[model samples]
Target chain A: MLGPGDDAAVLRAPDGRVVVTTDLLLEGRHFRRDWSSAYDIGRKAAAQNLADVAAMGADPTALVVGLGLPADLPAEWLDGLTDGFGDECALVGASVAGGDITRSEQIVLGVTALGDLGGRAPVTRSGARPGDVVAIAGRLGYAAAGLALLLAGRTGEAFQELTDAHRRPRPPYACGPGAAVLGATAMADVSDGLVQDLGHIAAAGGVRVEVDPDALEVPAELTAAAAELGEDPLRWVLTGGEDHALVASYPAGVRLPPEWRVIGRVTDGEGVQVTGRVEARGGWDHFRD
Target chain B: MLGPGDDAAVLRAPDGRVVVTTDLLLEGRHFRRDWSSAYDIGRKAAAQNLADVAAMGADPTALVVGLGLPADLPAEWLDGLTDGFGDECALVGASVAGGDITRSEQIVLGVTALGDLGGRAPVTRSGARPGDVVAIAGRLGYAAAGLALLLAGRTGEAFQELTDAHRRPRPPYACGPGAAVLGATAMADVSDGLVQDLGHIAAAGGVRVEVDPDALEVPAELTAAAAELGEDPLRWVLTGGEDHALVASYPAGVRLPPEWRVIGRVTDGEGVQVTGRVEARGGWDHFRD
Candidate 1:
């Protein structure tokens, strides 16, 4: 593993295959200085992209970050961000191998992550087959509920859990490759709303995915927060983005790991269907409302 | 190779290793919408990053781009930029494998390039041994001269070549891996000023790098522009940035490719010493003047 002294970093890919993903986080659009600490932004940025590599059923190896920092930004903030990147990368045994930083008007972070498949076949979104059992491994509506609390100016200690979830979504990192080992047909990271994200799998696989609303256990904290905000917690569970939960379809009758909970099923036809009383708002679209 | 529409791209790293580099280009700091077309900006961004990969003595494989665009930007501009990326990638048989785009007030471009070393040891900066031949394999000072012309509002038919150099630098992509095959001891992309960037190699290698001014051909156009601007052409050749030329050190008496011009030698001392009348501005430092 060649390190940072060179113009480019060299990483070994034992299987002769490499996986790459990239994301752009801009100030005001992705985060606000007033709302999130530089450390949290760093963790969130790294988490989102690492989760993407996980969604591809690969182990993240390194991250190449490109930063556009404001001229007057405090050195302390950048240090905090660097620490955040280190901590997040440590969670998955990855490193901040290389990056570029420059002066700009606002904080803009561009993170690219590389991963290794370890000779295993990639569990792509289009691999889902009919009769597969859809499952999720991690939190769903918590981030959405947390975001709602922040927007309503209700930052209370009692709701800190939800708020923290919004600030940093704890993605199920290992479940990605674990699911692959378990012969997962299709997998995706729930960065967008559950319904919308699953719709991608359905669209790619050309199979109808039906979610059983009863199987989704909305947390009591999310329920209470929703009540305080005069909003439906189930809606958050259905449409929240940034939760970074791993959603995958395993073969029918396959014994799933303890971390995974059955939530839906793959069937003939197309599109994703959530069967219940919740009205689905789809998911977050940056270009649209 | 896995293409777009997946969570992450899968690329074949034939030698079981991957080389990666990243760069950030801001709208005002790196380029201006009024001065450079969107296509040129795209090519410039890709060129800068790809040049870094090439500097590592690797054959560029793919690029992942992250773009932050203004909502009001023209569709035509975006299309042109895409075309530019495609065309530039075509030069090295690379492709825009994947990327993420988000809305921002200004156009921010983040580009990450991946390359394959083809079983050759990476030609790093610290590998330059004393008694090596210092050489260069691309244009020098032309981009700097072009910038001077642009700032002076001297863009005319006669200086089209110079302006084009600044707008879109055509780095000798093949020469990078070619130099490695020729046993280059150390290599670096002259993104910063030549003397300043070579200083990096000197510092890394702990050997003195001596540049002979007589050997560096200051293009006639650069000399003509320097005369009009009352500036030293040799100064530009020594310290101008953004040319993205490949400067390298080879073993003494080794035959270099035809494109390479012998400029100097490596000695047992440290740092870069240009033997001539011009002063070295070192190189472009984003944090300093």
Candidate 2:
């Protein structure tokens, strides 16, 4: 993989097509420096964009980062931020190919992830057919739960893991290409909550997605945190965003990878639905209150 | 030719390799609201990134824009910005492939341009050799002159072109691929003043670049503005940046393209030099005062 120091970096696209996705993270908007370390912000930025590539059923090969920061920002912070990008890319054998740096009032990171499909037909959101089984890989509400702990000033050892999840999500990198190999019909990453993201697939596929609430296995961390805070853990599971979980639709009777759990089903309709109830929409919208 | 609304965009990299470049522009730092319209800002953002691709001797195929804006920002502004992107891409027959939008305190844009080499060897900054003739393909001082007019509060029909140049630069898009076809030994775009940018090429190529100041054709606009502002016109030509002019070195005895003018030559040694004098470096540096 080519690196920075040139006008542009070159990346190999052996299959004659490249998958590209971008994400933007702003300081005080996406993350707070006082709460999350620079490393956390960088890793989160990288993970979110990389997950987009994975959702396309492609293996990420490179990332181009465009970073804007105040002039007075510390060099150490930048170093930590780049290290975070490097570590996250290393997780799935990708590299930071190139980037641009500029001065801004606050820290802003724009990451573009490039992926290779390795000749497999891309699994798109529009391909989910009626009767396809919906499955998900990776944690659902851990990041949201972690955010709640941070907001409540809960920094005890008991809440450390939850808080860390909020700071930096761990996306299931292998599940994207794995799902493709397993013949996934449609796929999307849960960056904007499970329901909202599923709605995207449903709308694109011209079908309906029904999630079985009972099938969702809530992690103990979320349950414990919800009990301590007197909040419903299921809300976080359904509406929580930033978990970067990969969810896919596979034809019925197809064997799924071990990490995926059956969560729902697709039908001939439109939008997403909870098994026996209509759920209110809850997800992050940049333009909405 | 694909557009946004997907997890990732699929671009055809027919040559099995893609060239990538990115640039980040902040509202206050890169452009002032009073000085530039949303359309101008968007077009400028696209131009700067696209110029980097052109500098690499590749044909730009697509761009991914990551925009961070305040939630209350006007919808018309966003629409205008996207139109500018579309207009700029149309100039080179490219497309805005995909992007992400998020909330931020100030408008921040991160643009990544992807280009196809089209079977040509990439002309890199490291390829210049001793005796190679240095040449330029676009305007040099218009943008810097425009900025000077804006700073001096000289806004009128007489200075409108300069002011507009400050707002939106017209990079020589065709010169990059043209230079490649003509066998340019090394190439770079003059985003950061002529001297500073050539210094990059010199450093990368491990050769000395000598500019013949007498040979630089100072445009009448720059000369008139310099006279009105009591500044040296040569300063704008030599040190003014943001022109997005393509400069390259070609081997001796090779026929130069009609649009490219011989400015100087590459020689043994290192760093950039003016034929008879040592000039102070002047260019945009994010970290420098």
Candidate 3:
């Protein structure tokens, strides 16, 4: 219920712990003004940070935003950005509790999302164990496919959905808490591609993550766009990022939520393998990519 | 005990509520590479935001940072920035809880500080009443004077303190909770100049704030700098910002903490007045100044 208009805002942490995460989205590196409206950028920024909170199996509670704007930016764009933040926060019953604005040469957004654990222990990536089942609970390559379509100038009506996914990822916010309730051992958000993110889990858990590529149900939307672009849809699923999917490891025999589909498993070893093939370093590396 | 390397960080909010605030600092606008070391920028950034948390009468707990850097930025600079953040947070018994890194056209920092109120009510700006004594904790014009010395290229060892103040502000972190314990009715940090920030408290509290210039004991350093620059030290004390001093209103007869010095009083009016003169407009306005 706390709002802006003060030096700082107060949020109730009934569980005695707060979940916090931050993300920075720069104008050219994260999004292009030509490709995304201010509203799209704002929503994407909020979603990415909120997804991080969700990945911790916490209930999103509030967000503090730090925005940098060029003086030449239009007032309407700022208004639209505020609305986008409001709408995205509304999705998880959170509010823009406080924010700071500053002048910058280009648009930059720094968002910190706070969450409540509701008395549950946080599920961390380091908790995965051998023989655990790996599952995912959201779209995988749609955003990447959308980006491909936009870059290829394939903006037909049939490809509008793909482009929209790229502009504003619809993360399955409930899946995080659901997985935690269902006894997930470890979890992470697939913001940096499935294979790459799972690699983090594998590295932390000291186990090998082996994905059966055939188990992945490539959505028709991604496949059609891949076909149009003469690209392999499997690569998008394996290496493309920004999808904001929820991936987790659960012990065998635990009843999995219907939304979570088995795609891989944890085994004795190290690193990530897709169908027994070690994937080359891929996904988003801010400096290198 | 929780730190980085996770999707999100968990902070113990033992008071059952957390106070949060965020600030964005852009290169060339908030700090200059030529004038400030990366460590200086980092410490200043942390100080400003942590001061905001303190202004709310909370004990600083943790900070989440979002950093954007050009690809060519040296690793040593990044390390220095990290050390600066860690050192500043250590000042308030806090930690750098989590952070994100990204590439941008220029360096930018988005910092969010969280605090625990320790069961004390937040001293917001809206609680001042007529006849309340207005007091300040910490320096007033030192930072402004430092900025002046730097701008004038007065690099003599005599002016090094002022220049250092400009590069990094030292806020009175404990004064906030002390003021709250002393029954402060309203409070704010003087980040946007004393007069400008006092206006915020006056407007929020629906009372007039009147300051006596004679009551302010201008530091000799600021006075000397003003003499050398042919400027009025009072102007820097009144309208120059970024000092980050804590100003609060306390009911008449309430004993103030030793750190707080009475410099004014609340009266029946609508805004801030310095020695019977109403400031037309002063302080930093991001879009305009």
Specify the highest-DockQ model's number: 3
Clash-forming residue pairs, model 2: none
Residue-level lDDT of model 3, residues A176-217, one tens digit each, is: 988889999999999888888998898899898889989888
lDDT of each: 0.89, 0.88, 0.88
Docking class of 2: high
Judging by DockQ, tell me the better candidate of 1 and 2.
1
DockQ values of all predictions: 0.88, 0.85, 0.89
Clashing pairs in 3: none
DockQ of 3: 0.89
Better of 2 and 3 by TM-score: 3
Best by lDDT: 1
Cα RMSD (angstroms) for every candidate in the order listed = 2.3, 2.6, 2.5
Question: Could you tell me which 10 consecutive residues in candidate 3 chain A have the lowest summed lDDT?
Answer: A280-289
Tell me the lDDT of model 2 at A193: 88
Q: What is the TM-score of chain B in candidate 1?
A: 0.96
Q: Per-residue alpha-carbon lDDT of model 3 for B1-289, expressed as tens digits? A: 4579989999999999999999998888899999999899889999999999999999999999999988999999999899999999999999999999988878989999999999999989899999999999988888888888888888689878888888889999999988888899999989988888888898898888888988987888888899999998888887777879999999999887678999999999777777755443333342121
